[model samples]
Target chain A: MNGVNIGVLAVQGDVAENVLATQMALEDLGIIGTVNEVKTPEQISDIDGLIIPGGESTVIGTLSMVNGALKKIKEKIANGMPVFGICAGMILLSKKAKDRVVGEMDQPLLDFLDVKIERNAFGRQQDSFESEISLEKIGISKFPGVFIRAPSIIESGKNVEVLSKFNEKIVAVKQGNIVGTSFHPELTGDLSLHKYFVNLVKTKH
Target chain B: MIPLAGDLNDAKGIIKENIGSFGTKRGTSTLKRGFAHMLKNGVVMDVTTVEQAQIAEDAGSVAVMVLDKLPSDVRKAGGVARTASIRIIQEIMDSVTIPVMAKCRIGHVYEAMVLQETNVDMIDESEVLTPADETRHVWKWDFTTPFVNGARNLGEALRRIEEGAAMIRTKGEPGTGNVAEAVIHIKNVNNELRRIKSIYDDGDHQDLISIARDLKVSYTLVEQTASLGRLPVVNFAAGGISTPADAAYLMKLGCDGIFVGSGIFKSDDAKERAQAIVLATTFWEDPNKVKEAQKMIDERQSMLGLDTKNLELRMQERGSTA
Candidate 1:
């Protein structure tokens, strides 16, 4: 078995928690892996898989663009690297984001997930909430998911499988080796989702 | 003439001593100066892009909250974290003389440390949404620079102050887009303190301290609002504040100020809302003035999404260790 090395995008957002969660997930799964925070383009090359933690999407997109990691990440994903985008990370991976509250604020997306996202369809800060979701497609049932000013998947390509939804709003989806979630699975104490993503990495690598 | 010259020299020495004493009195002057600037002219704008941050500054907002894209993106992508990159923070700071603030996860001391080095004026230990550390609350005492922490009630506010926070804000429960809870919390705290003080005679420090200590409350709370007749120290209200009316409501509730995170920037009218909120803070008592201010806020409405509840829970779970 190849020892997996998972790197989290640490430019901004929940970098530390993702690292800890991933580390914990790997341990729970009995998988041999090293989790590290990836900031530079050079760091991206060393990881077998990458987790983009929840954070501000535009800032991450702009920083990735300026730091020259956006292209590198795209290239890596194109070359068959396993990547999981959570919340803002999912937004970055999508083909397009619509209904964005900021009005035509251009974001450089990864275009890996082949999906369209609606930013904050659930309302603003105080409207944030949590719900139990069933990812039956991925064998996940009754998973308590936290949605904080979360987005919803309005549309997805033929290749995309709707994984979960809350209040009929699409909150989780998976396309091939790429997994995207509107709600933060990492924030919840559930390691099953992380384990599921890690399985994708194992198969891909 | 010779004696007068010596006396003048002595007075100059005394003045220098007083200045030194003043510096010691304000142990965090470097931090307080930045906050004072925000209180005067800074407007907190909601933004999804570095470009939006720049635009907000240009449009008169002193600082901007970098969100994950924007609310519009939610229908297509889902709500995302809008954390600013170090480079972005650097750039924004470089662009404006006014201080820049960023949201960090509670107990994410490393992120706070990074922000401190970024030269930003204040770090909102905000559960504004998406925390980096899920295990601990970001105690303001842990950081070297001055920080503002959120409070949902008087107890929470007093705790933050006790933890050496330079400022406190009402946890404006993210994503609700309603200010009722914040207003309620503030009013309850204020009323409770007044009721407690009404029974005690003036100059009853011992009695007041004993009551607060017995109730497991902050001495600052009793001293400021209940005892010495002042509002709680460094109190601000955040979350669910959408209109000038909301801002005015908090001011009426005795909040020192308000932090309009998703409210002003999320509205269709950003500039007007920003200005209206400022006006509302200044003329909070006059309903007619507030009504006039409401017109201004109503004109500029935009939308953004925020989720600070999970972050708050995370902070609570972590407690005030970090």
Candidate 2:
């Protein structure tokens, strides 16, 4: 690949850290890519890959809709742009999301992934925890999973590949050009997950 | 199915026991600092009612500060303004998932204790509230809950850090709808930091000792701050942030985030203004983004203006030695 252009949705949640991680991932893999925040339709169209960070799903969803980024993102993802979504980002990417504590929510979502997940499945904010998850498909053995008010994948379509699990509860999934995770990879200092995503973007590009 | 596992059940049990267990010294300084870190480049709106707090949460505020009255109102209605009623604070807490912070007088340790017992996520030893002691502040090192204080210069910031304040904000004239004081205070801190950093680079720990004595903080902390060229804890900009432009200006000036006090709810279109401020704070570097945020609100509906010079009380001057 000549070069890759990556973007992180700036609608909400840990935007800078995602940018930093992606930059580090590029350096580690010896790849050249410019990572920037995508908030407008122009910014959206200018990226080869995108990452939706973990934050309040409802807020991010609503703001994206209001700002006209939601439609552009959905169109790009459907056109096979490799996208990574973490936590609330995962919820936004999933086709269906039901809250464990509050039941189903009516919030806007991208609905690009063929998975059904539960928001805050691990528990509340204070119930968040960190643990090791082994992802075989990514060629990584043990990865640190930081669950902060995270979601859980309860069901996945046949095309979706389960990447990792926590106590048999699905925490990661991938389908072709899209990847979603219930835990935050950016929060952890490890860069393998981002490196993997960058490689995915590289292959797709 | 994956498999039946007893270890998973034990993990669930531990979570169940630890849920809502914040009062028993279970929260460490690291945890508090981590929580505050999550609020960087975000907006924390000041709210007095559950309804306002709901608006704030809907507007994407990282947190809400529970207060009894708008700071301007507290200034207008000359009386002893104290901590907000726990009943109101509890109602607001129940209404929002974002952290709820309440203010106590500058030295009212008992009020802070009560707030901690109520399990508020954080406490503010605010000078905006009526001071319980003119010469002292709460020793926040004793509390599990983190405390945030106001500072006008490096000395005030270091002193508060020494007293265990996990965060600091410039004491701009609260409720004035003016951003000048915040601008001055932040610039003062930044200039002082640059001076300290230059001294440190010159290999002079001696100047830091005198600066520490002047700040009434430990010499080690001063040295560390000088070496880092920033406060150890997060420093947010607060007071008189009435517009998206104001929020963006402070963020560009190098404050960690913004605290909009009475600037959202007291203005017309609270929801729109609140959301606009959040957007500006998040994209402070982009002038076009800030312009878009500014166009989101109608300026004619802003809170009634106050000239900071005319205010009988300078809230920012309460504890300042500069």
Candidate 3:
């Protein structure tokens, strides 16, 4: 049995927590997968799946460009690699991102997911929040959603599958093999989302 | 999914009301502590203007410390350095999405209160600013906002933590752009922790009491520090860190993160240097990666460093002087 190999984009953000969650998810599924932090483009190419954890999207985008991993990941995604992005990660995957209060933002983004994003769609730091979100599409009924300086999906392409919503704004979506969540699922100690991503990777392999 | 209000004003109010009921787990301290924890392994840049804050944010700083002037400038000006103007602070807050932090003169609780009310994410009871109260420091436990204080050694770190500092940084002389003082201070704390850990291993309860007295903190906290082999809260490297190498060196020494002041924007290449420092700090364990980051900056464009010995105002000594 060949094990799945997963990579977490370690340019920045909550890398460690996601790594642990993925490991736990793999264990729960009784599947073999080696998790590693992908800093170089080579690492990104070698991974069976990749996750971009929540952090500062502006920094992550720039660093990914500097390290040359951005171009490589885009190629891998173009080839249909399964990628999961959380929070700022979700913002990066969007084709267009606008600030809810400020109108527009100019940060470097992967622009992979065909969706319009609203940065800080809820509120700023102190206004961060948590709520139960139904992601039944991924087989989870009520998953806790942790939103910190979170962004929500305002619009998506026809091919995109809407996964979850909070207060009526779209917060999670899946476009083909790309999955992005406005809220952090790993932070909530839920393994189903990560497991689902792993299963996506397995089926693709 | 509940549909949100169309109006931005209504959306904000609705989210606020929903979050208000849960009130977060534990209390104020826990919430603040959790925020500080998120800052671990990240760089917090000192910024003086809205432009600088934006640059810092664009450069990937986890947070920006709002200041009226850089510490080196504060020292050179020689007048009273107080909390940053509310107008500038608000402007910086509006400019950047990253956490905005500001420093208050030591023991100036009122200044802290103002910063907290302004909705800045964190406050620093910093000696970088002139001490407002010569005899005491602010009781941070009184504020809802988390406070980060400076320490030259383990005792000072423990004392400030006991005073309710949710975060701690080494009190190296600020504004020098010299990492020497910070290196020494961080080593002092690390070495002191190792010694205390040995004592703890030996079951020396009597020595713990005397150590607590010397640190001026509670015995239980001291014992906890010994048992954990580090400060109870996060400890960051601060004061006089200039180059990406300097940031990486401190990370290698086991500090959680870093705080860069005049070393950045004061230098010729603010954007490049800021980004390089963040990368180096993140990949400190890898010399090859650190070398790649080092190549990103020009040595000639780096900040002109001041000698720690030649400094007239020593911010690190403020803890004892008070």
TM-score on alpha carbons, each prediction: 0.48, 0.82, 0.84
Query: Residue B107: error of model 1 in Å?
Result: 1.8
Tell me how far the alpha carbon of residue B235 in candidate 2 is from the true structure, in angstroms, after superposition.
3.1
lDDT of 3 by residue, B181-245 (tens): 99999999999999999999999999988998887777888787788777777789999999999
Q: What is the per-residue lDDT of model 1 for residues B132-251, given as tens digits with 9 covering 90 to 100?
A: 664455655544455677765555555555555556666655544667657766776676657666735466778878866764556545565564343334466666788878878887
The structural similarity of chain B in model 1 to the true chain B, as TM-score, is 0.71
Clash pairs for candidate 3? A167-B2, A168-B2, A168-B3
Question: Chain A of model 1, TM-score against the native?
Answer: 0.96
Q: What does the lDDT read for residue A122 in candidate 1?
A: 63
Interface RMSD list for the candidates: 20.4, 8.2, 5.9
Interface RMSD for model 1 amounts to: 20.4
Scanning candidate 2 chain B in windows of ten residues, the lowest lDDT window is B1-10
- Angstrom error at residue A74, model 3: 1.6
**What fraction of correct interface contacts does each candidate retain?**
0.00, 0.02, 0.07
Q: After best superposition, candidate 3 residue B83: deviation in angstroms?
A: 0.8
